[model samples]
Target chain A: MSDAEDVMIVLDESECWVLLRSHSLGRLAASAAGVIDIFPLNYYADGSTILMRTTPGTKLVEMTIHSDVAFEIDDFTDEEAVSVVVKGTAEWLDTRSAIEEADRAPLVSWLPTLKYVYVRITPTSVTGRRFVRGPEPERD
Target chain B: MSDAEDVMIVLDESECWVLLRSHSLGRLAASAAGVIDIFPLNYYADGSTILMRTTPGTKLVEMTIHSDVAFEIDDFTDEEAVSVVVKGTAEWLDTRSAIEEADRAPLVSWLPTLKYVYVRITPTSVTGRRFVRGPEPERD
Candidate 1:
């Protein structure tokens, strides 16, 4: 078990992006009708943008109305955890070429539903933190 | 590997609350200043409400301003996944009795920070879904 004195370290932009690219599962948060909704999704990191697919639902409608959204991914062990958050604007990839390229990416919905509409999030800010568990220091 | 013909079933409110009680880790989403943010948190299910603790930061500040937030908890295996979402309003537990009772709750911040403020979310709605993966049927 990890001690209770571990500290959380802030990750830089490059490191944050690296972590984002390394993970495939994330949660997408958007607001509609003054209510916030979050959905778990599988995504692909394409350059500086994040790509995901969704069918017609609250998430798609909310993103279309309010492009500003947040996506988060995290992995944890018993001792430590790393979390990355991306804040950006979401837009649907309506072009044929864009959809074709996104189809080739590794992103796929875990559910067996048809996720034809592709949404891209162009990140405005990317931040991350790594929580490191270690031995507690003795007081002098 | 499971086939690609799995189905997603919408769970009832009772089932959703059951899943929420089963999991302690979740992501909390809040919005402020036209930006949405998500934080990984350890929470406790208190009746129909959700309880968590945190130090002063963007999460706390945003929740105080907007109050409207989304909380999500999900569990997955190689073949299937279950997700639950809670949409609610957040408020700090300021009363002496409230603080004392909350202190005894199971909610604890994983990080080694002083999370003295206890926040409670009275859920407005609770929804859940279960993705069941299985063999695909033969095509005619």
Candidate 2:
């Protein structure tokens, strides 16, 4: 009934955005000084942009050094798995108006630490895929 | 009874390794052409290295351009969240013996696509943190 194929299915841009809006938690990837790092954080998908909050730490520093980043969210069951990736440019919401705008996005920190820095990632490209979980096909 | 603090707790190296071994799915982040990308893939923890299989695609191409990559795994409940990040160098298992060795790992493809390329990530630094999930602490 679904487009669920024998294996992998490519998801369209709209599907990717839908998945992004449905999930609040994701991994943020950024590179700094030749090393790339991934951190799991809470984020809000505001229209086409991804909003997140962070404190003065490695995550913020790395993104500051390199504006290019990738944010990913995924979910899976026994039968299927889906993943969405957004390659974007990250910038801190430094202006008062921008910070006030981000303050309303419902993005909250998981820990008790102060996360005064509001960062937003504007997507350069969004892509997604769906994979049907199954055993490997026998080799010829 | 546990070291579950009210907020965030830094996990030790041994604890990080334990968590890594307990999970099979993670996000691998790599940078290419000044843009970073993250992919969710199923992987096997072989001793201190991460083993995975993939078809010829963007994930493999980017990682080849920059061997410095980050692999991350995370899990969370309503009460707590834990994440482990491994900053590592990824190398394709091209040799006959190396590919044969990787074949022994309990790694299988989730899709029917031919994933002939086997890759291994050797960790340079492994770090983890545990966050006690709760509402933000009231400020003074």
Q: Which one is best on TM-score?
A: 2
Q: Write down the TM-score of every candidate.
A: 0.87, 0.90
The sequence of per-residue lDDT tens digits that candidate 1 reaches over residues B1-140 is 33433487889999998898888889998876666788888899976899987765545554654388889999888788889999888888889999899978866456655445777889899999888755433322
Q: Poorest 10 consecutive residues of model 1 chain A by lDDT?
A: A131-140
In candidate 2, stretches whose alpha carbon ends up further than 4 angstroms from where it belongs are A1-6, A57-59, B1-6, B57-62
Per residue, candidate 2 scores C-alpha lDDT tens digits across B47-134 of 6898987776545654654388889999998899999998888888788999888878888556655446777889899999999887
Residue B131 accuracy (lDDT) in model 2: 91
What does candidate 2's lDDT look like per residue over A1-140, in tens digits?
22225567899999998999988999998887676788898999976999987775555555654378889999999888999998888888788999888877777667665445777889989999999887666543
lDDT of each: 0.78, 0.80
lDDT (tens digit, per residue) of candidate 1 on A1-140: 33333477888999988888888889998975566789998789976999987765545555544378889999888788899999888888778999889878877566655435778899899998888744433312
Q: What is candidate 1's CA lDDT for residue B16?
A: 92
Name the 10 consecutive residues with the lowest summed lDDT in model 2 chain A: A57-66
Instruction: Return the clash pairs for model 2, or none.
Output: none
